[model samples]
Target: MSNFAILITRRQFAITATATSRTVAQRVYVGKPDKISNIRPLAILKNKNDSPLETQLKELQMDTQQWHHKFWMNHNKMFSKSREEFDEKWFAKKQVSSSNQSETTKMLEPEDMAIFHRNFLHNNLEAQRTYDREWKTRNKKLLFLSAQVAFQRFYFKWFKSFFSRKS
Candidate 1:
């Protein structure tokens, strides 16, 4: 009877151990997807009636717009990831040094993000300025090209209408 009891206890222990191991193995961490990785380039629509110059201008405008979108998407994504990493490190350090022994580990809250925001901006001020300058330049170029295309389209339509009315 004693031998049977020992065998039963050993089997139960083996089963429990296997179940625990399976659960532990199944636990996995999944990080958030990168914002920039999801960005799709803007499509350029071309008209069959467009003149060579008009087509070129439209292409240029589309390219500039795509570049602008890509730049901002990549920059913002990097900034967000950097901020997250900083917050994680800060929270981990705080958790280690904090005197409160009963508190649970937690991520930085939304309210706490202001501190990181200010610091990040301060550190990246030069890069921010450069980005702003480049962004404005590209925007101006895009606007000018778009306006030119619109004006050409309007002038062509007006010329056709005037000639057709006379005929």
Candidate 2:
């Protein structure tokens, strides 16, 4: 046998090890659906039915568009930081083995095991904190989206009322 496999670094080996264990996987999209139709369509203009409410509604829609743009921009910025934090906390630092231990002998002392467990617990705690932070951000975004949908439905109902009364 060649020594080619033995030449890989620990990081490379860890990556290959994890990659082989997965049976099925696919890329997932994390972006929120930003289509206007997905939210709700703004009031369509009626012929010769210009009203103050319609004007105000149009202005509010414009303001909402700006708010959405800002929200997404800020979310993208925060997302990067959150992802980095998650990665940092999720993976534990590689522990260097003493020179005396060989790859064949998988032996650990009680003190070493205790240290290992402590590190594991610390990493787990950090991972939980990271998860909570991400969950909060996701929920906040969901709430904002629900509010938008509610606003759109309300405005559309008002628009229909105005058009029906005008006819």
Candidate 3:
């Protein structure tokens, strides 16, 4: 076939394939009821006030939410240190006051400068690693949160369209 004819054929084939794939992926819904008279319609109750049961359930739900909020807050505080707490201990310069000297520090200082140097280097390296880890973790959390929101929106749109077509 000529190039023009071949291109036309290929385009037609692609369009056909896409339509076939879509039809195949779509579910064939069956057994839809014509009327649901037994179950009360939500629209009928729209202008009505809340029932006592519903009011009690809503109050209980709110209480549960508050309890969960307080629980998580206390849990987080127990497990995690504030930035101010970390900075006060690690970043602040220590006083060279004689009254604050521990017996271990005094012994270590006199025995060898190499031991003190090694300890300082080890602590410095550990702090650096901790900071790097926290930085990466925060970035990862941000990326994950963004991806989750995008995925949920996509799923919501797809399901909405699919069900709307069915009905």
C-alpha TM-scores of all predictions: 0.60, 0.29, 0.25
lDDT, residue 90, model 2: 30
Whole-model lDDT per candidate: 0.59, 0.44, 0.40
Residues 1-167 of candidate 1: C-alpha lDDT, one tens digit per residue: 01111111343232111111211111112223335655434444555655777677767766765666676777787788886687567757766555542253354566567877887789788877987898788778767876876677667767887999999
Better of 1 and 2 by lDDT: 1
Q: Candidates sorted by lDDT, descending order?
A: 1, 2, 3
Task: Name the lDDT of candidate 1.
Answer: 0.59
- Cα RMSD, each candidate: 22.9, 19.6, 23.0
Q: Which structure among the candidates has the greatest lDDT?
A: 1
Candidates 1 and 3 compared: the better one by TM-score is 1
lDDT of 2 by residue, 45-93 (tens): 3223334444454455445545545555555555456544433333323
Q: What is the RMSD, in Å, between candidate 1 and the native fold over all Cα? A: 22.9
Best candidate (score: TM-score): 1
Clashing pairs in 2: none
89 Cα displacement, candidate 2 (Å): 26
